[model samples]
Target: MRAVTVLGLEGSANKVGAGLVRDGQVLSNPRFLPGQTARHHRGCVLAVLREALQEAGLEPADVDCVAYTKGPGMGAPLVTVAVVARTLAQLWNKPLLGVNHCVGHIEMGRLITGAQNPTVLYVSGGNTQVIAYSEHRYRIFGETIDIAVGNCLDRFARVLKISNDPSPGYNIEQMAKKGQKLVELPYTVKGMDVSFSGILSHIEEVAHKMLASGECTPEDLCFSLQETLFAMLVEITERAMAHCGSQEALIVGGVGCNMRLQEMMRIMCAERGAKLFATDERFCIDNGAMIAQAGWEMFRTGQVTQLEDSWITQRYRTDEVEVTWRD
Candidate 1:
């Protein structure tokens, strides 16, 4: 029997990526994100697609199905990718599958780390959730009640006038390393969910005054913010793990690439005698391979999206999909 091959397109946010996955392996994953505009994605998607095919040394005919991110993201980018996937499916006479963005991260984390039903800490620009699989659904145990952790970090970066050449969170991470003092920040964790809006507002209001008064340096603020935020995340994640009786913890999504956050999670996992699973930026950040891998699973389970029902959904929930592939 031939291995199932999938070509995936991802444009759910600022990044636009194309990847080829077959038999649980990523053959090609090329990504580019100049901006978050639908026009930018339209300009880059074709080139990205061509590059992915070239890198994989395959043609569109070799793919068994086409997959694309279906939502919980920006409306325009989701629509753009959906339209492209639908067009490709029609032109190549292949099946089409719409994947949930959060589920893609979880599935990809499991695939790459070989983690079997680990508790997932999914932190990205738009989402923060502690999840675990139960009854065929990736059930959310805890999440951000207000602004997401990554969004908080990004906003803080903007306040500090940090460079976003690579990413705002990454730059903050680098700066935090140079920090020696820990400025006190609000730590909010109510039950299972965390809130960052209050912290962001507090920091933004005091950051300039503190800097001018020499009360604390930017590095100090960065370090303080990271420690407080990551501590809150770790507390909630640990609680979720304990509740689920899970022995493995997997971190996914864009902000999961932060070494500090990973370190904090690793420490928490160690204390509980649980293993920690994390991938580098390629898998942690948004990419096409994650979507393709997810679509591959859905397709194998006899799931496909019909043309009339292939429209984009900006608020698709992770638990909405039936995980027919998992027991």
Candidate 2:
């Protein structure tokens, strides 16, 4: 079989990313943020696509297929990337593939880590899920009932007026390193599911009191927040591993890039004799490479989406996608 190149666009969140993949290899991945507002998704998508193509030293016609994140993201951003992808496919006369955003993260994690089959923990600003492959689907073993772990951290950063330049969560992680005290915060984990709304509320209240009294610093709050939320995530991921009877765990998404969280997960996995797999910030965060890799699998399996069927949705569940590439 001849080598096929795919251009993948991702705009599921604030970050707009473009990636080129050929024969299971990523040629280039670039991202852009037009502005802090969500209104710039379209412009950012176009810019990143250009940047990615330039970096890969390829033209639009060179791509054999066009793939994009289809759903389970912000409606506006998803539609923006979807429209661009569909238009590009029509113009280039390339096959179009619609990829599940969550599944993209999992597939990308597996691809980068070379994990055949592992329990997945996908944590991001918009999603938190413990998943495992079962019967041609990425079944959700557990998830957040309220906001995601990343969302909780982002909100906490906002409360402290942290800069959102690179990422609010990144700044919080840095501050957390200097924290010597661990403030008590609400930890809510109901069975396999976790809840962050209560924790967020309690933390915000604590932040206000701390600011007024000048007792606790932002570093302390950041530390406590990371410790509490990451611990909950690790606990749930461990439980999922035990239930699935899988010895390997793969962490994906934005929050998965946190060193503290990864360390905690590593400790938990070590205690249970399970291995943990995680990628760097490039693949773990919202990136187009993951989407391209997943789309390649679908494209190879004859999973193509017509323009009519290529629509954006915010509530597309991960389990709704059929894993045709997996046995």
Candidate 3:
């Protein structure tokens, strides 16, 4: 069979990205969303598309299929990307493929790390999930019951008045490195599910009380928060690995780029005689290459979405989509 080319668009969160993949290789570097506002997402999408194509040395006519993240994201941004994708597909008379945001993360992680059949830990601003492949689907073994891990951290950063420039989580991670104290915070994990809302609330209260009493510093809070929460994440990921009888764990999504979390996960995996696979920030964070990679796989298997079926959704579940491309 000839190599198929897929142009992937991703605007699930604050990041709007575009990438092109041919066969199993990425043709161009991804373009990430620029601003926090949704007003520029449409323009970002178009700019990213044009840039990706230019970098790939290909035009719209060269793309065999068009794919965009369909759901489980902010509505306005998803709609913006979806509209562009639909328009492009119609204009080029090419096939349209609607990619799930989570699946894109997982598949992209697998591709970059080459971890076959590993349990996946997907953590981001909007999602925190522990997944394993079962039968014909990526089953959710564990997830956040309340706010996502990234959201918890982002909100806590706001409490500390940290800069959201670049990223709040990254700034918190840097601050935690200088921390000397470990403020005791709530660690709530029920079965395989974890809840961060209570922890976040408790930390906010602690931050306020510490500011009044000068007992605990922001560094301390950041340290304790990361240690406690990352422990929960590692614990749940370990459980998922054991339950699925897998020896490898793949970490994907924006938060997966944390060196602290990666080190913690590495220690746990080492103790269990397992391997941990993760990508750098370029691939771990939301990107179009992952979307394009997954889209190429689905497109090869005759999976395509019609114009009417390419609706954007805010609550699409990872387990809802069948893993038709994977055995």
Candidate 4:
């Protein structure tokens, strides 16, 4: 059998990631996305693809297939990349695979971790989920019923007027690194699912009061935020692991790139003698390569989406797809 090379494009939101993947190897990836602002993600996808192909020394024609994010993301951004991907697939006369963004994260973690059947904890601007692969499907054992963790952080950053260069989440992660005292913050965890709305509001109020008294530093606030939020996530993920009867953990999604969260998860997993697998920013955060990687696995299992199949779902349950992180 011939090895497959897929040119992938991702523009689900601010961070646009494009790459070339051949037989699961990320040959090259070039990213473009506004840190603090939204931009022409559609066009950016094209630029990323062009640059990635150049870096790989391969043309679009060299790829056997084209993979792009299908949906479960912002409407405008999702359409922006979808049209470009569909057009390229038509023009190049290649098979097109529209992959679920969340699933891509899980698959990438599997790629990097070699976790065949580990429980997954995915956190992103648009999602938070605890999942497992069983019965030929990625089952959602738990997830956020409210706002996503990264979105909560970004919105808080906006309130602080934090520069959105690189990424708002990255800024917050940096801020947390300098944090000292844990300001009193509410921790909300409902069963295996977690919520951040209350904590965001409470922290904003604390900032206002502390500034009024001129006694609080942003670092302390950042520390408190990361501490509280991460603890909540850890608690919930641990519960899900216990419920699912799995000790191995895999953290996915863009927010999974946060060092603090990774540390907390690592410590928790270590205590239980459960292993944890985490992909770095390349796979942890949103990227085109992960989508292409997941698409390749799906293709191998005869899970290809037909040409007429199209969906722009904002609330796609990750478990809806009947596939695991591995073939």
- Candidate 2 residue runs with Cα over 4 Å from true position: 36-38
**Candidate scoring better on lDDT of 2 and 4:** 2
Tens-digit lDDT string for candidate 1 (1-327): 789999989999999999899989999999997664799999999999999999999998899999999998999999988989999999999999999999999999999999998999999999999999999899999999988899999999999999998899999999999999988889999999999999999999999999999999999999999999999999999999999888999999999999999999999999999999999999998999999999999999899999999988898988898898999
Ranking by lDDT: 1, 3, 2, 4
Q: Candidates' lDDT values, in order?
A: 0.94, 0.90, 0.91, 0.81
TM-score computed on alpha carbons, candidate 4: 0.93
How far residue 171's Cα lies from its native spot in candidate 2, in Å, is 0.8
For model 4, residues 1-327, the per-residue Cα lDDT tens digits are 888788777777777888778887888878876543235684466678888889999977798877888878877777777778788888999888888888888877887788877888899898988888878788887777788999889988887788877788899889878877778889888887788999898887778778578676777787888898889888878887787778799999888888889899999999988988887887787888888888888776666555677545665668777774344
Model 2 clashing-pair count: 0
The top-ranked prediction according to lDDT is 1
**lDDT (Cα, tens digit) per residue for candidate 3, span 145-221:** 99999999999999989998789999999999988998888989999999999998888876888868989788888
- Write down the TM-score of every candidate: 0.99, 0.97, 0.98, 0.93
Candidate numbers, best TM-score first, in rank order: 1, 3, 2, 4
Q: Which ten residues in a row are the worst by lDDT in model 2?
A: 34-43
Candidate 1: stretches off by over 4 Å: none
Per-residue lDDT for 106-157 in model 2, tens only? 9889888998899999999999999999999999999999999889999888
Off by over 4 Å in 3: none
